[model samples]
Target: MTDTTTQKGDQMTDAPLLTDRATRLPAGSPDPAEDRSASTGLSVHGLRKTLGGRDVVAGIDLDVAPGELVSLLGPSGCGKTTTLRMVAGFLTADAGVVTMGDRDVTTLGPERRPSAMVFQNYALWPHMTVAQNVAFPLRTRRVPKAQTAERVRAALELVGLTHHATSKPTAISGGEQQRVALARAVVQEPDVLLLDEPLSNLDAKLRVGVRDEIRRIQQRLGITTVIVTHDQDEALSISDRIAVMHDGRIEQIATPAALYARPATLFVAGFIGSASTVAGRFLTGTPATVGADDTVLVRPEQVTLCEDSPLRATVARVLARGHFAEVVLAADDAELRAYVTGPPPAVGSETGVRLGEVLVYRDGLLAEVVR
Candidate 1:
């Protein structure tokens, strides 16, 4: 599984811990020459890690260009986090290599590698002040006091946490603490930044705000980044591309739009977004090579409940979700969901379904159907 491929030019916030979110640099913002990887970008070649007599990461290969934000997304125990750990030099790979530019750091220890990792727990020392916590890494390197202060201040400013620099970790909210962790990671300006579920600590409402802050900082810095998370919405919104892994292997890698619009495999289609798959005859041309009976994968938003539509389904339930209603329909043996505006039809009433974006696939391969 050893393969080497070069990639290039592929691709947060806080305001006062909240202000950066509102004024984040737009996507494709200009990055300084030094922030951009001039000599090397992060690359994983046939990386494998086996533990407990089983392969946790089996022959994985991924390339993240300078300034790109790629998310390793999958359910727990799917090896997304393991892959990030290996890249950070926290875990040794059983096979394959990791390179930053042309330097092979596969055998390097965590501190020896040219990377910084922000842990899931926000690993801030309760004994230290916000400034002190962010400055710990610099102190270890024996950085000059004057330069360290400047860098620390700059980092705190980047995450909009300068005002809370003197406060202890216990004194701030979870969102503010998370920003402190981010500040620590970027204080040294490493070649790559690795985030391991950085937003998991925050509440549901805070998650989106914090997530937006992260994107703002990443875009502003233009540093290569790799994030590990199981949340599809997080990956979809934060990443330049997503690598969906399953069973310790990469199932597919594509931009969020491409992954959702044209999933290469059935697994990717099912994993990345919601859809109701129903097997129906290829009324016209088959999407697959063999022309076998295919399934139509229709998203809930793609479904329109119209009175004049030819295809009808019985309304089983309708759950109002503020802006739209999640209407569940029973069409023959298939149970499907649709998003419709206004009040839902009475339970057991019939409604027509007009599907907008219909994807046809056969034997797990994307195919075109002329229905």
Candidate 2:
């Protein structure tokens, strides 16, 4: 792929001790004006895409502030990838206007846009050394060898892979390869950086570490970014805001805390965190989206478990979570879960469950919020 294209696969060498350093463009030969791309806001208005006669990406509108990292989060087949492709100019939108800063880029191809991408699969050339792979983009653009060398060294250093600059892609570890792909993308210093499930292939422990590194690098550089992922934890941890997509359109877009505290729809509430549902009425008054008979939902953290209550429930199950235990209680054909610390009640033991700050919903839309 050339500088114009977004990004592709890659791999890296085993890096037992990776260094985390301040990330910025390195000294190089390119003109100072063109080397550092200015941060810019991205806007997509009436974006639509249809695949196989189905509306994969329905009409959608989004605006991302300069240097903000927004995530397109949803389950598989929610059109997140399609929307990303449209934004990257890889897949032409059926209908919509895509603008970066003030320039309308709806008709531009991937090569013409000032953006970079990192794919899930580290697509690296097996024959080329890590340094060479990172330098390929500069080479394609006819950059001077001396400048390319300096830039590649800085890029590798930024990703903590400077020691493996000469190692072949096939010889590196998977995590190392991922860093190499990231180095390649960041070396260009594009205005926008797009990542698609960048950490899905790593182990749980490694995933956490890599995600932290990504967040650090993104913050230090302040490049406007959009990441696509299904992992709730990943999106919540790194994004400035998250856009929850469902059935091709954006369900809700808000900060992590706001999204979790007050979801706009039941789908968002259920999708973001674990919530137990029961038929009940809202003493807080019926909201615009709710009806007379509302469905109340409470998160496990909000549900308290005690050995006292007039209406008792039987402890049905208990799941040990490292720091706390999730206890499932059954009462009158209804089930609720509570997060309990210390010692949880034994199975079949009778206990009382009290809900705090409930969320009311009617017809799958949020009706009321206690807090």
Candidate 3:
């Protein structure tokens, strides 16, 4: 995608391009122009919210560039929606500042902010045609008829829904309705797009397709986006960065690969993917020792079987898939599961297993044990 920017007073035409390869500044790279412009597109500082005398969003500090996709990922009721609402000006933050470019919108109403939101339910007007739905925002802004039609057509085409312009919301599939909603938001050409579980209503197969489409559209438009989702895979698949929330607090924020490979906390490690935590002790040299209460995390792929290995474990169960099998083992009162390529060992078989790559954490702190 390509962006053409025209600097004017308060109304600048900054068109963002979305493609497979979007250009980004390298980490910690400095740009004098960006510093002068305060080009950080979205900033949430010290955001706090409460509901029924309980703190929903304790505090959150986040930054998104002009064309970045960030996801707030966590289980249900972890305050992801509250934070998104705060950003979109749907809810006022008790103590914080929400800034888009240089404007502080913490106290602004939803309609006053230069942003759009796509709800989980699609929230399209059943009585309106796709074109009308896409043009709703432009109409609200009192845009001219010809201009509204042109922008609506462009937005619909961007979302691959140009052909459905005449279809009502009830006549289209769930995914198409969602595309209409997205097109509506895009027609406004807001500075940011806030998505609240936008893909949750679609079926499993459609969810995958729609998510890819959303990512493509977001990148193409170069709009800063923040998505709230409970599905970890969904967030990891589409987001440039993920902010994991737990207990109304932001736990960790990092790139998808970094968050998966080197999780900052035990909660993040367990929440991001499937992992097995085994009791073990860090030995001074050569090999680590197995013990109780000293948990070591290992991905299923980081386990291998060998007859000559020293660890003695009995195969308790075998769950076989097409390409790989999960072998559950009982070793010295500790239960662990290992992923092995090929056929699995039979139940009740005594097997020798070797640690492929173990991440040893003692007292919740990562330690440099030799093994």
lDDT of 3 by residue, 150-246 (tens): 6677778777788899989999988788878877876766668899998876789878887897888777667788999999999999999999998
TM-score for every candidate vs. truth?
0.81, 0.84, 0.82
Among all windows of 10 consecutive residues in model 2, the one with the lowest summed lDDT is 4-13
Write the number of the candidate with greater TM-score, choosing between 2 and 3. Answer: 2
| Candidate no. 3 TM-score | 0.82
**What digit string (tens of lDDT, one per residue) describes model 1 on residues 208-271?**
8778877886777666789889899999999999999988999999999999988887888888
Best by lDDT: 2
Q: Worst ten-residue run, lDDT, model 3?
A: 20-29
Q: In candidate 2, what are the lDDT values of residues 1-371, reduced to their tens digit?
A: 33222111111122221121121222221333444444578898999999999999999899999889999999999998899889988899999999987779899876566677787686788899999999886667555555567667878887779899999999989888988888887776666888888888777987888788778767776778999999999999999999999999999999999999888898888789788887664333433344447787888888887657555789999999989999998977677889999999999988876667878887888867654
Candidate 3 global lDDT: 0.75
Higher-ranked by lDDT: 2 or 3: 2
How much lDDT does each candidate structure score? 0.76, 0.78, 0.75
For each candidate in turn, give its C-alpha RMSD to the true structure in angstroms.
8.0, 6.0, 6.7
Which portions of model 2 miss their true places by more than 4 Å? 1-38, 281-293
